[model samples]
Structure formats: structure tokens, C-alpha cells
Target: MTQKEPAGSVAAVAGDKSSLLTMDFREKSWIKVQKKDGSVIAEYIGKPGEQRQLEINEPVTIIVGFAPGVTMAFRGNPVDLAPNTVNSVARISLK
Candidate 1:
């Protein structure tokens, strides 16, 4: 059996700001945006700034295959990618 590599995770703190996620892809990259329930919202290898801003009423989880050229912010705050910078991939929970 082939085992998948473990992914890094970061949680978004509950705050007063609206549940808005802003994604700016500076390069072509693969990304999966989903709700916490595992329902996928968007998944694709998109061009720069392809998915500008997504408004989800609930929390979401995003798995980014390439982190360097992607910019993601939730609730007006930037999601920290430093924790998984070396891994080249990040699994973030915007909950």
C-alpha cells in the first residue's frame, strides 16, 4: 500500500470579520478549497488570480499543493504559510 505524505495544518481563529477567503494565485498551481464537512468547493490548477475571493458562510479547509506563489487570506487576515514553507504543500483549516 502506498501511504500519502502527511500534510501541515493551520486553523483560523474565530473572529468578528466575515467568513471570506481571498486567493491570489501568482502562478499556475493546484489547489482544493473545501468546507469542513469534506464537500469540495473548488479544485483546479488555475492561472494567476483565477479565484479571487470566495465567500463561504461556514468554515473551510484548503489544501495547497504549491505554497510559494499562492496568497490566501481569511477574514481580512493573511493565512500564515510559514509553518509549512519547507514542505512545499499546506493543508489549512479556515475554521
Candidate 2:
């Protein structure tokens, strides 16, 4: 859940129930989350220091435009941003 969406910020979901993904942005960046069927959950240019928690209920793809200052936790555990990063972007598939 998010508290606010300033201009240029986007966070949404088509449906939900059980799974979860949380993001904490330490710097300005772009972020998008999508379900397996390609439906967008959240898509936005995040302001620095913003944090979001998504209740996924299933697996999803998360795209991070600037990997350098973003951290994520899935199902209450911290995720390793390495191994999936390229050119400062990260395309992570989480369940």
C-alpha cells in the first residue's frame, strides 16, 4: 500500500490476495511491477526515499530503472539485487 502519488508517480494493481513485494527507493528512479499475464500492478517514476509494499498473491516481474539506490524485500526477506542487474537496471522475477 502507498500513501501518496505525486505527479509522475505510479503504483497500481489489477488484483491480489497472498504474495508480496516491497520496495524502498533511496534515490529517484523508475519502477514497474507486472503480473505474469503482462497486466501492470504498479508503474511510476519514484521520488527519492519513497517506499511501497505490494500484496502480489502470485509471482510477478519487477523492473527497476536505477538499481544503484533501490532495495527490495520479498515475503519479508531482503532480496539480493545482484545477479539480475545490468546497466543499472534490474529485471527481477519474484514469487
| Native-referenced Cα lDDT, model 1 | 0.74
Candidate 2's TM-score: 0.75
Q: Report clash pairs, candidate 2.
A: 12-41, 19-57
Query: What TM-score does model 1 achieve against the real structure?
Result: 0.68
lDDT of candidate 2 over 1-95, digit per residue (tens): 84564676333444432245777889988888999999998897777889887776557888899988888887567888878999999999875
- Ten contiguous residues with the weakest lDDT in model 2: 9-18
Task: Provide the overall lDDT of each model, using Cα atoms, as 2-decimal numbers.
Answer: 0.74, 0.78
TM, every model:
0.68, 0.75
